[model samples]
Target chain A: MELFESGACDLAIKIKTGTISSEEVTKAVLQKIEQREYDINAYITTTPELALKRAKSIDIQRIQGKDIGLLGGIPMAIKDSIITAGIRTTAGSHILENFIPPYNAHVIDKLLDAGAVIVGKTNTDEFTMGSTCETSYFKPARNPHNTGRVTGGSSGGSAAALAAHECIAALGSDTGGSIRQPASFCGITGIKPTYGRVSRYGLIAYASSLDQIGPMTKSVKDSALVLSVIAGYDNRDSTCLNEPVPDYLTEIDSGISGIKIGLPKEYFEEGLDSEVCDITMKAVEIMKSEGAEFIDISLPHTEYAIPTYYLLATAEASANLERYDGVRYGYRAENPENLYDMYCKSRSEGFGIEVKRRIMLGTYCLSAGYYDAYYRKAQKVRRLIKEDFDKAFKTVDAILTPVSPTPAFPLGSKINDPLQMYLADIYTISLNLAGLPGISVPAGKTSDNLPVGVQFMGRVLDENLLFRLAYALERNVGTSLTYEGAVV
Target chain B: MSVTRKDVDNVAALARLSFTDKEKEELIGTLNNILGYFDKLSELNTENVEPLTHILPVQNVMRDDEIKPSLDQETALKNAPKHARGHFVIPKVIE
Candidate 1:
């Protein structure tokens, strides 16, 4: 098998058994990235030298008969928003185009300790703000399945890399379907662990309460492996939970005989594509045949989720992004005549159109005259939205829904309409709002052959249940990989 | 309440963004549309609903007040567009 096509666990075993050297595997992946990166736009930076050196060091440790950590020498790409010491981490924005971190994020530290080889950073929507990767200051990532379509954002590049076999597995951040939607679009598996299940210590902040770092991979088991290495408490992030990390890999393939899945009625309402709805329902039927029971669930505040998310996210973003003024850090205008001009010119040039739009909306909601009407009211509505999920989880092990209203839209299709763009996150945003764990597993393809993802949301820290269900669904869904210009 | 073009302009300025006249006109329409949709919230009886800051029941995860070393000023300023003597440089505020 091609090095990039090798699963994370398979690669680790091969390297340890002397069937393939770590250096050889790294070289193959680097070569594949060099050949295909331009078409997919998967990577923002390629660290071939560092990757090869790291691979060699791992090989040396293996020769010394030392037990390397889980995922030793596996090539992994990270979302650019993640901080990697000495590596340029842009978050797909011009504002921090040259920014290099002096410290690693907790995930990065864990991945390195596990002996995972870091290939490069992948692209994202600038500051992880868009559903489609189109808003990136860097080029929008193309869906490896079809070049005409987008790989979903803000972790579009990470998913795209995984789909195109540019990397074995990649890291992605999901604020509102950033990871899952893109994973769905790219026909890969992605997981968004419950908020605080994974530490956010070195992730560049978007909306602090909603942003979560998660895993994107070619298979469900690979995601479980990656999550095991990264999910843990950290002293740096106060929000990170202090609970013991569960043995996720061991829990896979646990029988789904008694698992009860809930399908929310509102998720299949009118705006859902007929094809996506059909595929999702068929997935439910398959689960039922596999001895899973289904129940109809209602999350009545679904209508308010998009609005509530926007208000709260933007309100928080307005405060979180306040540090980016020309005074503190990031890009500043050249030769400004005054401080006000410096701030205006620098931000105007630094942020892309989408980032600017969110910042404006955020500032407006939090502005003095509008705080009560917008920000405060939205917080109250946010409670109702969370209550909707809390009420649903009482009766079900997990709630199932479509990842996006439709499969990946064509690039530039909804870019001009901000509201239309925001609505794309409808099914996924409420999970973030409720701070629950969710995963997007490829259910099947539409009749037209575009991949559709079925999302399973679990209660807080119930990622183990989510993964077991995803693994079962993944086995039933079978492989649906599609490449542009290739026969499905 | 109806949002006006002046509201858009003021918010844009406060956010430190510059927009073209055409972009401004377009955004005025979009923002108004979004705000119109949000008007639905006013009809709901949320008088007794408590505001939700976080969904998880986590709170007050405070850390000790002990001083820990911070990133060096040079490293912090490394990404600044302009810097001088380990500090980010900006244009003069008042002259």
Candidate 2:
């Protein structure tokens, strides 16, 4: 039986029932990575030996009548940012090209505990910066649907792997729509969990306040499974919520009957690709017929989201990225004239163009005299944006919006224009700014077959509700592209 | 909003990064263009709005002031580009 078309849940049952072996599933996924990664560039590192080892152990445990956990024998890919001990983890930067971590990230530990085998590390925008996954130091990760187009990034590789069926599922981090945007472009489902919902101890920080690690998968139910395993408190991350983790699988099927969904007029306004807009409106109608109510609401501060996000995210990124100073690890400049010379050369040489641009921008924003006008003002507007969502949530249960303005665009289109690239994140950045839970599910495809994702954002700590709504939408539109498009 | 070559050079210095004359010219243009977009925020008035440093309500995370085992020097220095005698090697300081 070809296990590549199935999801983690289905594969778990197959492994538990003796219908298939864990080694077999791992082999299939590994083969897929080997075959498709050349064209897709989805993986930065593929752990064939380790994956086989984990799989062989799970198979042995099953033969001995031992109970494996929920993710037992499921093959998965991890974004490069997550630390995996003894595995070469590069957060898609040349500086960390050969640096291997001495410890596993909290999520990696959790996934291993749940019997998930990580097959590879996916590519990402360098330092999780860029909207298109083009900034990766390794190579550009192309969209699986159309080779000429790009996978929306910083979590582009993970989303691409999921789209190409190279891995059963993968983990992605969203600072300002990294996960959701790529998931949208690749035609998969991804959840940017509430801030602090997942531990960030191992995630390479871009914007500490807004960065979150979440799951990208072929289906909403699979995302729920991956989330259940990874989401929770870890003392290592101060921001990790101490609240109890809910069994998302239990209530996901509860359906969004009588759920008052908000259609933010601002999201449907100008610049949204008409086809993308139509697909989301059609999704609303599909749910409206299924007992979901759509309400016209406004996030008045929507227009300010781009400027505000750019300022604040870059500010945080500048500070957070200061750690890469050519000191204890990573890349270093050779034969520096002085300590100062070493710091400048190592960073200037190690970082890519976009990373350098952001660091410079951030440094400029936080510099004296200009700080209050830019950084402080952006933070103030950020509050207004969050308040806007808060007020709208009072009247509606959840908000639905288009994931991106357009479908997968050609790779080079926005690369040269910084502002144009930043605008691609318009719909998704505010959720991060406000620290809310947002999920992007494949709603429909354009006439040209490019995928369009519909976003559903829930109030803080309302991931369970978000999952339920995503499940509702998924059941109606059915864009689980892993099976439908996995003709290979 | 009128960022110039001098502004880019100053920011690059603060960021501890260096670039060539050509790159600096490009940087000045890009920075100026981005600043033009950022200038849009000036249109909104935020007289009484509080700046949210963090989205989460939690502040000042506390942990017990206790000693625990830490990463050993050998493992910690494993990736150091230049190291000798359990210390990172850097260009001469305190000249």
Alpha carbon lDDT of each predicted model: 0.86, 0.91
Per-residue lDDT tens digits of candidate 1, residues A119-190?
999999999999878888979899888878989898999988887788888999999889999988888899
Q: Model 1 clash pairs?
A: none
TM-scores of the candidates are 0.96, 0.98
Q: Report the poorest 10 consecutive residues by lDDT, candidate 2 chain B.
A: B1-10
Per model, state how many residue pairs clash: 0, 0
Interface RMSD of 2: 0.8
lDDT tens digits, residues B1-95, model 1?
77788988898888877788997887778778877887777877788988888767778888889998988877777776677887666677666
Error of 1 at A15 (Å): 1.8
**Model 1 stretches astray by more than 4 angstroms:** A479-488
Look at candidate 1 and tell me the lDDT of residue A383: 88
- Give chain B TM-scores in order: 0.84, 0.92
